[model samples]
Target: MLRAYQFRLYPNKEQQSYFANYFGSVRFIYNQMLADKIDHYKKTGKMLKNTPAQYKEEFLFLKDVDSLALANAQLNLEKAYKNFFREKSVGFPKFKTKHKSKASYTTNNQSGNIRIEDGKIKLPKIGFVTIKQHRDFDGVIKSCTISMNKAGKYFISILVEQETPEWLPAEHKIGIDLGLSDFAITTNDSDESVKYANPKCLDRSEKKIKKAQRALSRKQKRSKNQEKARLVLAKK
Candidate 1:
């Protein structure tokens, strides 16, 4: 079965910059190919097939990123077109805009191009970067996808193929029935029932939260005081 392990990444300033560059390059390739296909269909009434290799001459800057990433972007674009035609419910592929889209790029790990060792991961174009592998896993690494969230946090998800045992229904399973008053009513395999009370932490923190929210409303937008109030409210 396919499994994925996500780990938080800690890259140096230069490496983070490189990550942005890669994300932009991959996004550019995807958008460019999609736009080309649309234009071709409109004019010639036929789909124009543009591969990643065909884009290199026009977009020399794209060479800065890992070639595999660009190829995958094209693959993803083609898949989108296929899905749109095959599945009547799906919509057409849309263009990707920088800053508006999530920053990410995926690279294959064929022939051990990508590897993890000693709390570090070796990625294409980017050297060894620090990571927090909190959990241990066993399997053959298949691919690695690097991504950054809007919060300025970076992460890497490693896809792995493992020899997993077939799943079987548990003999001693428990089913929980949710309730409005109680947290839940759990019925175990033995047919014994247990009731759990709801933890009303919200009732305790309601007053402080309301105070912070009020203070936040009074502060002017884009002002330092407002920013501070927001941080305070977030902490609460």
Candidate 2:
């Protein structure tokens, strides 16, 4: 069985710079390979086979980042192509833009290159980074994806492989009916129904979110204040 656990990341200045490089490098490689594939298809009427290794000589900076990250970018391009061919509804892959694209990169664990110890996570190319591990997990590390949100918060989701637990026989069964006013109405074998009230999470925070959004709208576009307001709104 495979499971994924996500934790907040706190990287220092150097590590943050490395993360920026990794994210940019992955996006660059993916877009470059995609463009080449399209041009090759247009000229030769055949698919082009390309790898990050072929571009290493031309782009020396690529060598500074994790090799696995580049490889995963290639895999992502391949998957995009496959999806387009398999389903017409799934459009062709588009180039990633710095402003609009997601800031993230994925890398696989090799020889224990990725691990958690002493309240930190070890990553390839980057040294141990502080992590807020809310809970502990037991499994072999498989791969991890590092991402940064619009609010400038960084997070890592670690994928793991583990054995499936044995299931125990059920002694009773219940039927649950979902609703808007009530969260759920569950009835057991005894025909006794219990209603759970809706928490109304959005209703509680709606005013704060709206106020932040209005503040964001009043700021000048592309200005530092606007960016700050956007982050505040995101947090809200």
Candidate 3:
């Protein structure tokens, strides 16, 4: 069985720069490969065979980042193409842009290249980075994905292969009724009912959200202040 655990990441200045490079390189490779495939299909009516190594010579900066990260980008593009071809409802792979695309990259574990030690995680080419691992699990590392959210928070999701635990058979079943006012109501075999209150999350933070939105709206378009305000609003 494969399970994923996510933790917050804290990288130093240099490591953060490396992360930016990795993110850009992965996005660049995916978009470039997608373009090549589209052009090849248009000209020859066949798919093109391309690899990250082929472009390393032309784009020397790509060599600075993790090679496995770039390879994963190729795999992601291939998967997208396969999905589109397999089902028309699945749209064709679109070119990734810096502003709109997700800021993330996945790299596989090879011979224990990815691992956690102490309170840090070791990544390919990026060295050890501090991680807020709230829980512990025993498994073999398979892969890890690094991502940055709109609020500029960094995270790492580690995928691991582990033995599935055996679950005991249930002695009794409980009936659950869900509603808007109350989150859930449950009745067990004894017919005793319990209600869980709905924590109106939006109601709790409505003022803060509106204030952030107003601050975002007041900022000038394409300015640094606006970007900061946008990030604040995203956090809200």
Top of the candidates by lDDT: 2
- Each prediction's TM-score versus the true structure: 0.82, 0.93, 0.94
Candidate 3 clashing pairs, residues 3+ apart or interchain: none
Tens-digit lDDT track for model 1 on 135-191? 998888999899997557899999999998899987688999999899999998889
| Sort by TM-score, top down from the best | 3, 2, 1
Clash count in backbone of candidate 3: 0
Residue runs of model 1 more than 4 Å from their true location after superposition? 166-169, 199-236
Each model's total of backbone clashes = 0, 0, 0
The segments of candidate 3 whose C-alpha lies over 4 angstroms from its true place after superposition are: none
- On TM-score, the stronger of 1 and 2 is 2
Candidates in order: C-alpha RMSD to true structure: 3.7, 1.6, 1.5
lDDT of each: 0.90, 0.95, 0.93
**Which one wins on TM-score?**
3
Error of 2 at 68 (Å): 0.3
> lDDT for model 3, on a 0 to 1 scale?
0.93
lDDT of 2 at 129: 100
Q: What TM-score would candidate 3 get against the native?
A: 0.94
